[model samples]
Target chain A: MAESDPHPQSSPVEPVSPPAPATAPVDAEWHRMSPRFVFVGTLRQLRGLVIPAAIILITGNVGRGGSELILIGIAVVFTVLAALGSLIEWWNFRYALTDRELVVRSGIVQRQERVVPYGRIQAINVSEAPLERVAGIVRVTVETAAGGTADIDIRAIAQDKAPQLREALAAARAQARQADNGIAEDATGAASTVATETPSATTGGELLRRLSTPELLALGATSGRVGPMAAVVGATLQFGAEIMPESWWDRIPWQQAEALQSVGVVASLLFVIAALTWLLAIGSTALAFGGFELRRDGDHLLLQHGLLDRKRRTIPVARIQAIVVGEQLLRQPFRRADIRFESAGGEAEGAAGDSGVLFPFLPRAEVRALLGQAAPEFATDPTVPMSTRLPRRSLRRYVFGATVGWVVFVGIAAAVLGLWLHRWVDVVTWQQVLLLLMATPLFAWLGWARWRDGGWVVENGTLLLRWRSVSRQTLITRASRIQRREMTADPLQRRVSLASVQLSVASGLVGGHYGLAHADRHDTERLLAMLGGPRHEVVIHKVPATVEPS
Target chain B: MATNTFDAGEAGTSRVIEVPERLPDPLHQLDPRARQLWRLGSAISGAMFVGIVALGTFGAARFLPDFEMRWAWLASGITLALAILNAWLSPNLRYRYWRYDIRPDEADLQHGWFTRTRQLVPMARIQHVDTRRGPLDRRFGLASVVLYTAAGPAYIPALANEVAADVRDRIATFANIHDDL
Candidate 1:
């Protein structure tokens, strides 16, 4: 009967009430976030000014005498101002859940209010950072279908209240959708439906997958982008050299050192660098994805992971535009691949590892099964021979495009060195020229590889394009997600009746454009037609007979 | 290959559906005033170039001992020749090649002289449409219709002022977009 109360809002309004009964009519009333939000807001404001304050203090010390106190006073004044701003922001912010939309009113100076319809919400993420965890609170972010501008972030809420808010919002969305579909429901019925749909810890979800510690370690070991690590190591060595005492350098006895000893020292240095990079990579991966678990709740996939700061991300399957399966060169031999998603609306830009990854490392064999279980619409026969490889003629084009310019530039440099510097033997030896000539064949092989790996396949309403630059990438995207279509051909491609087809799809900050080069002209036309272009008719011409012959 | 003859109602009257080799209608070219706008812009740029060259020659002659003014003059003369050629030729070429077609579902644009690029943007994907007029464009009574899609914005440049506004409104209508708060 409590669940069936039609006019919950009719109850007497109470301010600052503790956790209410499950059937309470708090939905229509404005509610301030958890009181702990003040602390979160203050910290956030302080974090923004930390670097500036540090710079001020450092410069104050270096510039003159007794200016330190003045700089300290300025820093204190800045802190007080920021704290007051945060207090005002916290005071002005209030959120209310109406029947149709979530209305958030906030802003001290601008007087801003955002009314987000429940039906438009794409996903809700509840994350607990280290500080929030200690404070016994969580941060909730609501994303809507209006792309970048429509996201709403609630900085701090009690941990227990988060799940309730999520459930309430979800039930509201479902009711709205049902109402839109012509389901006439009384207020009591809607209330009862919401009560029934509210999910508890043990209900409404099925565990799909979880990553073990060993798997996480493996993922870290095989993680891509070693170049950054190398750069970091180089920078660290340079810094170390600057900080080290002169005696440390003299201790190396470089004047009397033998070539073998120097070589050993260099080898050990490389070893140390590699070991440190590996350790750092592993440490970071474990921290980010230590206890990863993916669960399914109706149309949403809930992913929770982290070592220190737990994050719960709800991804609506419908908003996903594409799925990319990437296999790094080092991981390919082990038959492991990383899976990422291209979702339509969320943060415009995100950390490389944070936003898109569905899973970091999965055995290649299991990718299809995983996709089937999670996103069945994208599932297809992975072994199907639907891909059409680039033509042999394209190999020459690739080679010429990739290497000819560099080869010619090197040739000119060598010629200049030989003629102008009169140092052909020292600067541009015959061996060097031979090496430059050999690059042609080497680049030809690379071009052949690229051609072999490059292909496009259409199946199950999705276009799967596979291409190779440094590492091979396979992009599987639905045709409906494509925003634009372009067929381009240079003079050379036109002569061969070849064209490149580019499909623009909503992704990342600016959107992503993927192209399949050297596709047949007829195939490109067919692709256009498939993408809802005008239907084309083929005409046959008949030769006329001469009347004089009769 | 074998040819089969089918009977026709009238003794040799045969009809076949033809897939046209080119677009059904010729592409709509930019407004002719676009050429005048380009020429004005080029002339301003040429004047700036001449000023820079004159200043550099004067500075070198006054400051440097071994500086030869003839080489500077020759270089400046070559630049002015190129500028004049561009002013005379490039506007015509650009106007000839820039064409656009706005259909109910999509907009197709083709432009460029030597390396032509064609783009097709579906109406449903257009996020916003705007009409922009620069100072020179305002004097010429011309504007550009810029369509913003998720991919990026595309411009149909140098249309008559009213036409640009009309095109923008048409695209907005076709896209079925209404501003929402």
Candidate 2:
């Protein structure tokens, strides 16, 4: 990225600060982002055309049978317009470090200015646009705790300046907090610890774990991310088939496929598709987390990753609402899990204000050690073969819940395919259709396992709820951080005196909800009562008004 | 929850689960006039839906001269019947189920008979509060107190205007969270 490039020409700007800004002072000159920002941004906008342009060249013609020159003409017009827009946007962009806030002003048609208070700043990250693969530019996204959106993004800055600007902002934030708190040092150090990617481990930070090549590649192969990519690729292929000519359909080796049916050609095709998906997963995972490093400096966890983008994230240990230990279906055999912690009201799965996955792939046994040095709050390990499992009566419900739906669905499919479809077009043989019924036992077994795996416990104020579907997920959260608790039951459950409890903890735009279904009503009620649920009428006079409303 | 009378993890050992004597009752209810508001709201929306169905029926007649208005009539009949039923029966049942109480530390809510649900939102978690009133609601002299927490908005609907204001105040006064996180 351009941000990573050394900027020999750019002079270092002095750290400037006055008092806490009330609004904008007319006399103060606002600082402009890098001029290179504009050039890279324009190219970034044009990046979408690369695929189309390459396809057009390879095809050697324009279609819908349109003229080649006309296509190029349209492309040239779009390119010019995009470049002009980028240039104008860059010219209007301005930012300044106030005493307690970072003031940024930018708009195309509307005059917009955002003042992000340093205290509420969740993360100030150095990220690259997914398309800015070759471009040396970077994006400085300022995320606030207000919501899971990037409040301010300074796009396309020189690599070296990222560290400098981050430090200046940090220094101002420290001063601001110091004056605000009337203390020289706060435990949070909120923004005092400047977000830096230049090897922060040397500065009072402990390096926890850095994934090696074998580990990173292994993580890629087993990661749950492959499923979505495969779906996307499948969708794209379907779309492509719709757009392609009839001649394209003639290229397939269907006769060979039919001949190889006895050799389980369908299974082999599925295997091939799975392998391709695995390969794609590895490539994307490596690119995303090539040199993933986990470091802890007092109350914050610094994450440095992305082979190409070179993104860095700092998560305040105190802000974390819940930590998730998840074992994907493929990774279960290896006894590996990914550890990620969600902070309150921050962006999901991306470069800015990311749900911090400190250990993208780790041996399940070592999670305790990692949690101890990292976040001791989540160090309470709910053991395997949990003793607090759901009641045995709940087994029938779980098994019925999982199996009934699938059995019905499969039954309907078999009827449609074997009886109706075969009558008209011999698409599926009765025996072949009947083979699907074999999956019912698998579904039933999964349901039974889910019941066995479901467990909940509250110990030392840390609530642990464990459940397994296709993947096993164990959520560990502080009781105090839980924003709300919910218990629900249906008529059937009412008869059995069973209920489900869902606890919501603040994470991202909407809080994350984790729950266990079919817990005994008594246990659910007990759990709720423990988590501050009122069992008896509460006296209104006890809590003195905490705040005087304006 | 503080009782800790039993070990919860011992559930799988075939020990009998003690059914509690009774669940707590969030007995404090909404304003009696709130039912009229919900009824009016449902009726208006139902009327609009019937109007749309009638329009669709007429519009289709132009394209398909042979098109019978059977589906439209059936749909309109169902909508009106459901609307009438809702306006008559649901308002009372809903009012009976909808209950909320503001405790010192949290707000307790219970509703939905078929799928009973109870929610507890902590006082510290409340980010802001608003008293919302629509024209229809205003006509009925009812308002809703919405509590916006970091998680999401929790709604306590169909309160008297003055009562809504009081509830909003109590929630707002308690929700002034100063945490930077």
Candidate 3:
């Protein structure tokens, strides 16, 4: 990908402003991104193709049949096109730091040009992959208020340049803010000229206080089915292979067998590998993001994470749509907690922002403290913890309904499987049928556990609602962010004076929900008041001065 | 010193706001692109029909059942021709009608070389503004000013570089003046 010059819309010769002075501090406006940025980005993009290419090659070989020559030629063409595309994409990608903006120009045919004016850029994130670390290159991604979709990555820059660029962007943003605050006449020229050099705020060593290897191992071990599931499947497949005749293996060709291996040996091996791999991945990820801390960098919260990706997310404090604090039964044993915030950006797994796992595991106390510190306004009354509400008698109905469904499913499966085996081998007996019948109680018990955990609590402006099954999710969001609210009561619930209230938020980030079912009218009213539901009447509750973390 | 710059500019203020070409509302502004897409789609469909005819009339007559691969060249030529036509016609037709006007407090963008659109974005609503010049823009010394708000970013394309700079500064000035409101 050849770098399309900064702005194809205007000429380079057009006078915008004079270049920065040589004496400009190292911590100045924007550090010119490395020339090798395209090379590194191209490499990163190509890395993703490796897995897909392997899949296509395997599939093509299997489907080739008698036309092996044609298949081989097609594969060669595919490889060549992919390789050429990687090169074209690499050549087309270019990033630069002008006095006014951080510019990224990329694309093969229809070029996309992203301009992050220093003032509007909220975050500068530098992430180092294991391979990049070896290459002494890090990816510095720039995030702006525009959204995460256009976040620009200046790839393969020197490790040293990451901090410098981050600082430069920060200072540039600060200058923009200064301009906005009426400190400067020309928001443009004056921002470029205001000279100040401050060393980038170094991430303190306190972040290293994250979980130990044992703690991480314990977390991964607790309630993780992938490992045990793999072990069981592996044992089953091994048993099957042992029982199957050699003729069965001979009848299936090698290509056919290899394709099936993913569901067979590979699937089983994944679990075995996942058990240890998850432990290590979690530990390393925690270490990298441990002591995860956030601070106000101008109007944005500057976040630094990673032992490897070493990413920084500059999220505008105001763009935060909602906040969620999650804890699982497994994490309960260790008293570890996961805290995530939903921000207006692109989607990511495990968190709201495009960056995954904002703060994966922290102590319950730490979660509150961090939320309070990071977003003080939204985290009003940090001392006041949320009140808990558990589902009442009506929960029994929900549980019973769930059991009936589960039993019906299992009953159908057992009847069909048992009938099929009866003619050929010994079918499942009455004892097996009785055991299957017992599954209703099992499902009911699980549902009851979930109902027992579900509740809603209003903490000043923030609403904390907890929902749980095997996996637990607790969401805490601001009252104003709720875009819409719905109150529903079933015939059973109405008889028992129970209602379920749901709140919708703008955008899909913190789903438009937090259903509080079968609570007291006073409790429901309290929720309605917090949501500013139809009545607009709220009974403010006063709490004791003494504070505690639950 | 900062106050001095504002004080100096106040004395030379021009009240007669120049209403240049206006850009339509966000949905309307995309009209040109939408029309182009419709045209391109129809063209491709028409080409497909023509391809069938050529294959039957000429391809079967010449290449016959053996050298039928020759149709690939015809398809590639048609596709490339369409692509070149799209690049040339789309931007040229769109900007020809997109009208913009910058006032002291807000920007009124009216556009639609074909389907008319009008949008009024208050200066205060602009969270930030970005000015960019592409290769084509550079040749004409034209630039694009993108005004970003909480909803999304809107573009004012094909302004002269100096004019773009001036408009950006003016918008920034308005944003500051009305920020409290």
TM-score of each: 0.61, 0.65, 0.40
Question: How many Å off is the CA of A201 in candidate 3?
Answer: 13
How well is each residue in A1-550 modelled by candidate 3, as lDDT tens digits? 2354442322223222223222111232323344454455455656677787678667755554666667567657765665566555555555556555555555544444455556555455678888778667787776544433336766667888677766776666667556666534433332322333322435522232344555444444553444555565656766897899999978878986677547677686666656555555455545555445555654456667555566666555555666666676777766677666666543111123432354666676676667665655455322233475654676776687678888888788678768876785468777777887887887898678777767776755677777765656777777656544444555566566666666644333223345656554445545654454222111111112211121
Which residue ranges in model 2 land beyond 4 Å of their true spot?
A1-204, A225-258, A264-277, A345-356, A384-387, A408-429, A533-537, A540-550, B1-23, B58-62, B176-181
lDDT of each: 0.65, 0.69, 0.54
Q: lDDT ranking from best to worst?
A: 2, 1, 3
The root-mean-square deviation over C-alpha atoms between each candidate and the true structure, in angstroms, is 15.9, 14.4, 17.8
Q: Which lDDT tens digits does candidate 1 get at residues A260-328?
A: 457688798789999888888788788888888777777666777788988767665655667777777
Q: Count the backbone clashes (under 3 Å) in each candidate.
A: 0, 9, 32
Rank the candidate models, highest TM-score first.
Answer: 2, 1, 3
Best by lDDT: 2
Mind giving the per-residue lDDT tens digits that candidate 3 earns over B41-144?
Answer: 45666577656755565666475666455565666567657665765565555544465545444555655544334344555445456666554455444556
